[model samples]
Target: MSPFVIAITLSAAVLHAVWNAIVKTAVDRTTTLGLVAFGHVLPATVMVLLLPLPNAESFFYILLSTVVHFGYFFMLGKAYQHGDLSVVYPIARGIVPALVSLWALILLGEVLPAQAWIGIAVIALGIQLSSWKVLRSGVGKAALGFAVGTGFCISIYSVVDGIGVRLSGNTLSYWAWGAFLHIFIAGFIGLRKRATLAALPLRVWALGIAGGLVSMTAYGLVLYAKNFAPLGAVSALRETSVIFAALIGLVFLREGNWKRRLGAAVLMAMGVALIGTSA
Candidate 1:
């Protein structure tokens, strides 16, 4: 992993954490997510007009990623319905890196360095530590199931998109097309919640659109980083967002047990240092 790729991935981590925090704190998560999907549509539509179409070979991966993302959104919405950000976010994001790495090695033939694997383990441990209280107290079976499902969806799409972009021969084009495909997801959600979606205030709409943009940019950075680094390593580095979300939950949402959460954040930071140095 080059420093440039690491920087891009870390930047994406911050943005990813911020947008997720927004959705976690929103009054209507599903509706907010729908609007965020709309946000993707706007930029994607524009980029599609400006850029050439992606290679034919990449279409299959793009379509597959879109389907996987639908499952991800569904699982994520359900998880949030039954769990707290501190608990749900960590579990949902924490499991992705290792799964992605394993899949990449088996399917994509991308092997990572030993230090990178250590960093991934450290980050995963830190993420679990951040949510130790909730896990110890016992989370609902539904939330746990949904969160794990969401993590699986994330891993699948991470590998899919990594290969898709690499095959596209034009990173921006693939990103644009991928963003454009979010319209199908937004449309499905919007049709299901037409009444509620229409009733939202301008401020809520603005927030959703803003979050959408942030989320798109965050993932776009990750996709770009994937072109330069091993998929699993990038995925692990991205999971640092869980720590950022924990801090955000503490400061903005006023969640309890700041001491433990801060300690967990420190652990994640150490993992990040290991990644940066090892790279």
Candidate 2:
């Protein structure tokens, strides 16, 4: 990948970690999640109105992605509920690089060089190492299970959007429509948590909406990069978000051992260097 795409994906990774940290901090995660979806809808609606529709061929991918997002949100909330941000975030995101690579190979016929595959493995190892304490203890089975499920959902949508945006012929339009369709996700969550959402304070609402904006921008960057890089390489690089999450967890959430994360960070940097050169 080009340096520009690398920079863009890394920026997205940071923003992604920021939003998930927001969710992990929220008192009412499910309701906060709904507002985050609302966040997507607010900007997406304006974009959809201003931009021409994405190709019809991309619509199916958009719809399917929306449905998959529902499961993703649910799994994420559950995972956070059952575990710490440090533990849950790493496990949930760490597995996605390999899975997306496999899916890209099978579904999209995209292949990577041996160096790229090795880089992905190194990144995955670094991510898992971020949560070594909890993994060794074998605690939070529910959190681990839900996090794995979330990773599976993420990989599916990553590949789906990778293909969708390529076919749409307009990256921004594809992103806008995909985000706008989150209206369904927002509405469903709102209906289920209507009482909680109604009682939320203004500060929480603002935070949720802000998190939504961050989330949208992060995914938009990833989708845009897909146009320039192979799906597996893009995803492996993006999963570096887990490292960002680890730092956020340690410094902000006060959740993990900085010593362990420092080692993981070094490994992640090495992995990034390998992948960067693979292009």
Candidate 2 stretches greater than 4 Å from native: 131-135, 265-269
Steric clashes per prediction: 0, 0
List where candidate 1 sits over 4 angstroms from the true fold: 272-279
Report the Cα lDDT for residue 239, model 2.
73
lDDT tens per residue, model 1, 182-265: 999999999999999788899999999999999999999999998887787788788778788878888898877778776776
| Per-residue lDDT of model 2, residues 54-74, tens digit only | 889999999999999999999
Output the lDDT of residue 153, model 1. 99
Worst 10 residues of 1 by lDDT: 270-279
Enumerate residue pairs that collide in model 1: none
Q: Which residue pairs come into collision in candidate 2? A: none
CA lDDT of every candidate: 0.85, 0.87
TM-score of 1: 0.93
